[model samples]
Target: MGEKDKAYVEIYDTTLRDGTQAEDVNLSVEDKIQVALKLDELGIDYIEGGWPGSNPKDVQFFREIRNYHLGWAKIAAFGSTHMAKYRAEEDPNLRALIEAQTPVITIFGKTWDVHVRDALRITLERNLELIRDSLAYLRPHAERLFYDAEHFFDGFKANSDYALATLKKAIEGGADCLVLCDTNGGTLPQEIAEIIKEVRSRLGKDISLGIHAHNDSDTAVANSLMAVSVGARHVQGTINGFGERCGNANLCSIIPGLVLKMGFKCKAGEPERLRRLTEVSRFVFEIANLPHNKYLPYVGRSAFAHKGGVHVSAVSRNPETYEHIRPELVGNSQRILISDLAGKSNVLYKARQFGISLSAEDPVVKEIVVRLKERENEGYQYEAAEASFELLMRRIVEGRKETFGFFDLISFRVLDVKRLEDERSLVEATVRLKVRGEEEHTAAVGNGPVNALDNAVRKALLAFYPELADMELEDYKVRVLAGEPGTAAKVRVLIQSKDGEDRWGTVGVSHDIIEASWQALVDAIIYKLLKSRRKRLEAA
Candidate 1:
C-alpha cells in the first residue's frame, strides 16, 4: 500500500533531549548532530534537538545542526512555558526558543492546579495566562507549534476541570497539537485509554492530540499504544526508553508495535526504514558509550535468541513456534547461545554461524558440547564471550588443546608498591611469552596491576604483530562468583576489545582477579590476531 493510503501516526523522537537526560548519557554537539542525522535517516517526523535555553551545549547544538539538511525530519526546540513574572516576549526562555530558529517549537506548561499553586507558586488563572501567552507569542515564528501539557494525566486525575482548562488555554494560543504527558509515567494502559477518550470527547474529535509517556511504571510503551488505540495521532518517546529516572517511552518498541501489531503507519514504520531500528538503537548506545540492553524488545541482541535445547530444536524447525516477529524485521538476527543447556542442534547452529563445516553425526560436535558444558561449570559464560567459545571450538577442531598457534603465555608477574609518603600505589608488570618459537619479554608500569599486565603483554607482542596496535580494550567487567567466599571467591572477567573494524568479547575465570583478567585479556588478543590472519588469508 502507498504510504498516503495508510492510517498515519507522527513519530516525535525526544532522544536528543529526553534521552540525554538519562544518567551517564552525555552526548557532545557532534554526537547530537550525528544522532539527529541518524534519526532523520530512520524517518522520524520530529527530532527534539534539545532545550536550547537550558545549557550552552544544547544552544551550540541548535546553531550547529543548521548546517546539515535533514531528509524529512523536522528539528524541534523544546522549552517550558514563559515564567509568570515576565511577559512572553520579555521572557528570556521564550526569546531563546525564537532564537533557535527551528521549524517546530514545543513548549510545556503546568496542567495541574497543584503545580500552578505549588510548583509555579502562581494563581491557577495566572498559570493559564502563562500557557496561553507563551504559545501565542511564538505561534507565528514556528511552522508547527506544540504545547506539551506537562503532567496532563496526573492533572486530569487531580482536577479534570483544570486539566481541560489548560488544554483550552493551549488551543487559545494556537497550539497545533496538545500533547498529553504522563510525566510521572504512573498511568496504566487502561487509564490512558479512558483519559484520552474523555479528552477527545471534551476537546472535540477535530483537535490534534499527542501522547508523551514516561516508563517509570514500565508501562510507557503500553500507555502510548493505548493512547494511539484511542485516537492519539502523535507519539513522543526516546529510542531504547532513554530518559530521566526510569525512562521515556521507547520508540524502539513503540514503532514496531504501531506498525506491525496495531496497523498504524509512520515514517519510521515503513518496512525499509523499520529494518534500521536495531542499528539506530545500538548507534545511540554507542554514541553515549553505554552498553546495549540485549533484553530490549525488537532491537536487542537477545530479543530473538533461542537457547534451550528444546526451544532451539523447535525454532530451527519453525521460528513462529517461539518468535513473535521475525528478528530481521527490526534488523536483529537469531542468536543460538552455547551453554550447558545446549544440545547438538545448538552446536550445529553455532558451527554454521562460525563458518565451520560440522555435520550432526560428527563425533567432534558432541565433544564440543561436552567441553562447553565443562567450561561453563567452571564459571565460564560463553554467551557474552563468543570469542572464547569460538577459540574453544577451533582448538578442538584442529586437534590442539589449551592455547592457539598465535602465541602462548609463559609467565607473568605483577608488583604493587605503596609508600606512606605517596598518595597512590605504583604497579608494574613483567610478561614473558612464546610467539612462533621465540621468547619475548617486556615490562611496563600502569595505574593498576591489570593495566600494567595489559601494557607489558602488548609491549612484548607489538614487535612481532604490528596489527595488535590497532586493537583497544573497550570495556572490562568482573563478576564475583561464589560470593559467599567473599574475598577468596572466584571471579569471572569479561573483556571487550575492538580494532578498526569489529568488536569481540572474551571471558576467563580464576580465584585470583589478576589471573582471570589476564586469561580474558589473552583471549582478546588472540581473537584479534586470529581475525587479522583470517582477513589476510581471505585477501590472498
Candidate 2:
C-alpha cells in the first residue's frame, strides 16, 4: 500500500501504567524502565510511563527514564483532572505531570453525568470546567495532549448531549486528540462504532479521535478495532491485555489486526518487528514475574499447535486449511503435538524440529508414531514436556546418542521420621551411583521426600561434574490418571529444569510418585550433560 493510501493509527501502550493494576502485577522502577526501552525498540508511538503522584516508584521511574534516550516512542505521564477544590495549576497531580517532563500528557476526566454527580459530588457544569482547565493547563507543557473521556460510551447512551459537551470542552481547551474510553467495558462493538460515528459527526471531521477500551466483556480488542473502523485514529491498550479487572484491549492482538488485516500503518506494526510480538509479550510477563497465558491469540503456545489426526494431516498438506495466519508472522511456529490422536505427519514434523533427517516414507517414522501413541496411552503427555519428546525421538532416530554413560544409578532410598514431642517431621534420602569404575554414595535431608532426593542426587554428581551445581529443578507438576486405581491411581510427573542460561522439561509416569520423580530427575540431568557435551564439540 502506498503511504498516502495506508490508514495511519497511533499505537499507545499503557502496559506500564494501567497494567500494574492487575492483581498480581507490580513492577519496580528498573523493571518499568527496561520495559519502556523494549517498547521503544518495538516502535510503539507512545509509552504511558505511570501516574507520577500516585507513588514514589513512579516518580523514580520518570527520573530514571530521563537518563536514557528512546528512539521512537514518546513517554507519556498519566493522571486525572484537577481536584474539585484546587485550581489546575495548584493541584499536585497536575504539577506532577509537569515534573515528569514527558513529551506526552494523558489525563482522564469524567464524561458520564453519574460520575460527575455521584463520584465527584459536583455539578455537571463544574465537571466540564475541570476537563477544560486541566487540558489547557498541561497543553503548553506537552508536545502532544490526549484527553481520555472516561465512560464515554456509557455516558453517551445515558445522556448523549452531556457526553458530546465534554468532548467539545476538551477540544476547546486544545486537546490534540480526544479518546473515547469504554471504562466499564460493557459496550458492544456495534454500539462502539455507532457512538464514534455520532462523535465524528457532532465534533466535525477536523478533530482527531482515539479509543481506549477494557476487556470485561471479552470485546475490548474488537471494540477498539470497530472504533478505528469509524475514523478513530489512535488506539490505546496494554500488552497481553493486562489491566485492572478483566484487562485493557490487548495491543498484541490489536496492532496485528490493524496493520496486517486492516491495511493500517503503525510504526510498531512494521512487519519485521511485528513478528517479535510474541517475544515482547513473554518478556513483559517475565519482568512482572507472572505466568504467561499460553492460549492467547496469535502469540500463545496453543495458538498454532495441531493435535488431532485429521487436523495434523490437513495442516501438513496446507496449513491455511485449518490455520488462520502463518504462525511465523507473529513469532510463533507450527507445533505438531505427539499424542494418542497423532499420525505420521506429527512424528515427521517433530523429527524435523530436532534436526533429525527423516522422511514420511521412512519405516522408522511409522515406528516412532506407534511408540508415541503407546506412551501417550500410558499417560505420558509430550506436549508440555518437549525435552522428553526430543530425547525419545533422538533415541529412536539416532540409536541412543544421548546415553553418554555419564553415570549409572545403582539404587535410592527415602525415610520419613516424626517426633511425638514436636509437630514437625523430617525426610531424608540416600542415593548410590557409579562413575566409570567406582561407586559413590551420598545422603541429604530436606523438607520433603522429593526435595531430599534432589539434594542427594545432585550431591553424588557434583564432584565429577561441577556444572551440575548450576542446574536446579524450577518446577514440578503431577496429574492423576483417570480409570486407574481409584485412590491409588497412576500419576504422570513433569519436571522443569534450568541451568544458568537455558531451561528444559522432562517427564515420567508411574504408580509411585517417588519413582516417577526419580525417572524425570535422571532424564533432566542426562539432558543437561548431553547439551554441555554438544556445545564443547561445536566449539572445538
Candidate 3:
C-alpha cells in the first residue's frame, strides 16, 4: 500500500463548514477563504467549504473564492441529498454544487430510520433513492463525491438491516467515499470501533471509509481514534473542536495524536509541520473571534502545566514522567503555576519565568509567596495578574516603593431613556469616583448603559494614567451566574484590554452589569499599572 494508504490515514478538516455553523461563530467569506488557504498550507488533505446554495453569504463565498488555488487540500463543497423524491440532476441544490466549481463535493443522506421517516418525512425506499441519486448526479459532474451517512451508527443500532441497506445505496450510487457520521453525537468509542469493523467487513474494502463524530459525550476524540484503529482512513472534525451543541471532534487533538502517537505521516520529504499544530489552532480561534480553550488537549494553555511539588519535581527530573510528549513538539510550552500546593521549586520556577532569579535562602520571597497564596484563598486571583504579583513580591522582598496607583470608581449608575427624536434610544451613565482619595464625579453619554458607564469611569482615570488614553477594549463578555430572570441574575463580566504591546484580562462578578463592568474595568487598569511597573523594572 502507498504511504497515504498504509502508514496513516488522511485528515479532512471541516472547521470552516461545520465549525462556523456553531452559534455566534459567523465568519465572513474573507475569513473562510483565508483560513482555508492556511489549512491547505498546513498540508491538510481536504477542507470542507460550506453549502453553496443554502445562503447568500455561502453563494458569495463560492463566487469570490472560486479561482483561488489550494495546493494541499482538495476543497470539498458540502450539501445534502436533493429533496426527497426529486431527481438529483434536476435539483437546484445539486446543480449549485456543480456551479461552485470545486474539485470535490460531499452530500449527506439519511442513514438512521428515525431521520428517514421523521426528519425527511419520506419512505425508507425513497430515502435510499435520495442517497443514490445525489451521489450519482455529482459523481459525473464532480471529480470526487463523498456521501455522509448521517447518524449511521445510531441508525444501525435502531435498525441495523436498514442502515446496512443505506450503505449499499451509496456504494451502488458511485460514492467515491462514505463517511459514517454520528450526527446526533451520542455514540461511544467501543461502539464506533465495533460498528466500523462491521461496516468495513461488509463493504469488503471496495471503497474508503471515514469517521465524522460529534462531542456530545466528550468522547469524540477517543471514538475517532478507535475508528482509525479499526480501519477508517479519513477523519473529519472542526479545528479546536468548534461545532454545534457539544462540538465536533477536536482536530487539535486528532492531528498530533495521529502524527506523534499513531505514527501517521503528513507527507514524505515535507518538514513535519505538525509542530505548528498549536499555532494553527490558536490562529483559527482568533479568526473565529473565539477565546482559545485553555484546557484543550495539546494546544491549550494548561496542556503541560504542572503545579504540585512532587509532580513538578518529577517532571523537572524527567519530563516523560508527567508529559506524554514534549510540549515543544506541538509548539506549546511547560508551565508552572504557583499556589498553596506549590513547593519551593514552584516559587523558584515562577520567579524565573518572570525573569527574577532567587535562591532557596531568600526567606522574604518565600514568605511573600505564602502570603500571596493566603490572599488567593481569600479570592484574589493572581494568575491573570502575574505582573501584579511580581510587583507585590518586589515591594515585599526588595522594599521598592515610590510607585503610582490609579483612580478608583466609588459608585456608578446607568439610566435608560427613550427620546422621541431617535428610534434607537440610548443609555446615560453617572459616576462618583475618587483618585488617590480625591473626589471626582463624571457623567457620560453612550450607546448603552454599560458603554456609558465604561466611558465615564475611564474618563475619570485617563487623567492620572495617560496610557489609558491609548488602551482599547478588545472584548467584553457577560455570563449569568444563576438561572434566574427579572433583575435577579448575578452576572460576570470578562474584559480584554490591549495597550500597545500589552494585553491583559480582567474578570468581575456582580448582580449588575454596570457593577461587574466596574470591577472588570478596575482590574484592567490595575493590570496595566502592574505591567508598566514590570517594564520599568526590566529597563532599570
Candidate 4:
C-alpha cells in the first residue's frame, strides 16, 4: 500500500492526564472541554481525558464531554490496571472506567520489576496477569483497548525478558494497541531506537505498537522520532510538551514532522490541520496561565526572528537563506532583534521593519543603536518590550522629539476590597507626579486595584499630554521573585500598548504587583503618545 493508504497512524493526546502532572497545571472541566474541542478540531484520533478514578473532577469531565459530539476523536477514559489481587469485575477502578461512558479505555500496566516488586508489591507473573486480565476484561466492553506498558523502556533495559513478556501478554489479551512508555524519562534516544528495533523485529507480526516517551533527558523528541522510524504507528503525547518530570515528547514538534515530513496520516483526513499548530500551542499555554514560548520549534516568537548585521542583511536579500521555511507556513512571524550583537545592517533592517526610515550612513541609527545597547546593559530589554523600543526609535530616527515627555510619576499606591455589594469591587489609587510645567497630584478608582493604580498614574500624566486618553493598556504581566514568597515582595510588570501599527512595552519593578503594574502602564501611555507624534513628523 502507498503511504496514504498504509494503516493510518493514531494521535493519542494525554494532555489531561499527563499534562496536568506538569508543575502548577490545573484545568477545570470547562478549560479541558475548550482544549479538547480545539484538539478535536485539529483532527487528533484520541484524547485520553484523564484517570477518572483519581479524582471526581475528571469523572465529571467525562460526563460533560460525553454530551457533545466528539467528531473524529474519541475521548478515552484513562485508569490503571485492576488492583494487585482484585478481580477486574469487582475492582472499583475498573468500574470507574465503565462509568466514564467513553468508547475507549486505556489502562497502564507495570512493565518494570522495580515497580512490580516494590511499587505494586506484586510478583512478575502476577503483574503480567493484571495486564492480561485488565485488557481482556475491558476489551469486551469498549470499542478499543490500549495498554500502556508504563516504564517499558527502563523495564526493557533492566530486564529485557520480562519487558518483552509484558508486551506479549497484553497483545495476547486482545489489546487493540500496545504502548511502550519511557515512564522514568531516563532512556537515551539510541537506546530507544535499539530496543524499539528489537521489539519491532521480534513482535513485528504479533501487535501494533506505539510510543510514550518523556523529556527528562531532553531526548524525548528524538526518541519519539526514533520509535516512529522503527515501525511504531501511534505517537502518544501532549500538546506543547506537557507532562511529569521534564515533560512528554512535544507533540507540537512530532505531529507536524509526522504528517508534513514523514507523510504519515495522523490528522485523520484534513491536511490543513497543520496551520493551527502554532495557535493551539499558544492557546494551551494561555489557558494554563503560562508564559509563551520564545524558541519552541516551528512556533516560537524567535523561531524565524533574525538578529546581527550579517544575518539581517542576508535575510533581507532572501529569507530562505536564513529561514528553514516561510514562517507563515507554521503560523509564526519573523522579527529582527536589536542588541549589542546587532550591526549597522541589523539596525537599518529593524528600523525599516517598523516603518521607520533610517540609513546605514545615517549618524542617528548608529547613535541610537549604541545608546540602546547601553540602556539594555543596564536592565532594559526592549526586545521583550517592543513598545518601549519603538518609542526610542521615533524619538531619534524619525526626528519626532517630544517637548512634554518629562511627566514622571515618583510613586503610586492602590487599595481594593470585594467586601461590597454584588456590584463590582471598589478600587482606589493615588499618584504623585512631576510634570515639565509643575508637579501634579491625581487619584482614580477602577474595577480592580491594578486598574485603579493605572488610572491614577495615567490621569496624572494626562495633564501634560491630553493624548494619553487615546493610549490604553493592551496587556499586563506580573512575575513574583524567585525563592521569595511574600515577605519581602518583588514584582515585575510588562505592559503592551498600541497606537496605529506601532506597539511598545514598558516595564517596572516594585514590591507590590499593583505598583509595578502602574509604573509599566504609565510608561506604555507615554511611549504610545510619543511615537504617534514622531510618525506624524516623519510623514511631514
lDDT by residue for model 3 over 1-540, one digit each (tens)?
A: 335344657788898889987887878886787678768767788888899978878877877776676677888888999986568888989989899888889899888889878888889999888888788888887787888899999999999989989989998889877899998889989999899888878768656899999999999999898888777878899889999998999988988877677766653113446655766787676556565678989988789889899988898789899999988777676766753433355456557766676887888666876776665443333333344455556556666542334555567778898878758777888888778788889889987776787788777777766766777766666656535776787766666677777555566657767777776766677767767766788999
State the C-alpha lDDT per candidate. Answer: 0.88, 0.86, 0.76, 0.77
The best-first sequence of candidates by lDDT reads: 1, 2, 4, 3
Top TM-score hit? 1
Q: Which of the predicted structures, 1 or 3, would earn the higher lDDT when compared with the native?
A: 1
**Which candidate has the top score in lDDT?**
1
The list of candidate 3 runs beyond 4 A from truth reads 1-5, 267-271, 338-540
RMSD to true structure for each model, in Å: 6.4, 6.7, 8.3, 9.4
lDDT of 1 by residue, 374-472 (tens): 886687866557788888898899876465677788899999999867578989999988988999989999979888999999898898899999899
Query: Which whole-number lDDT from 0 to 100 does residue 207 have in model 2?
Result: 85
Stretches > 4 Å off in candidate 2: 1-5, 339-540
Report clash pairs, candidate 1.
none
User: Could you tell me the TM-score of candidate 4?
Assistant: 0.66
lDDT of 4 at 406: 56
**Which is superior by TM-score, 1 or 3?**
1
Error of 2 at 225 (Å): 0.7
Alpha-carbon RMSD, candidate 4: 9.4
Quote the lDDT for 429 in model 2: 98
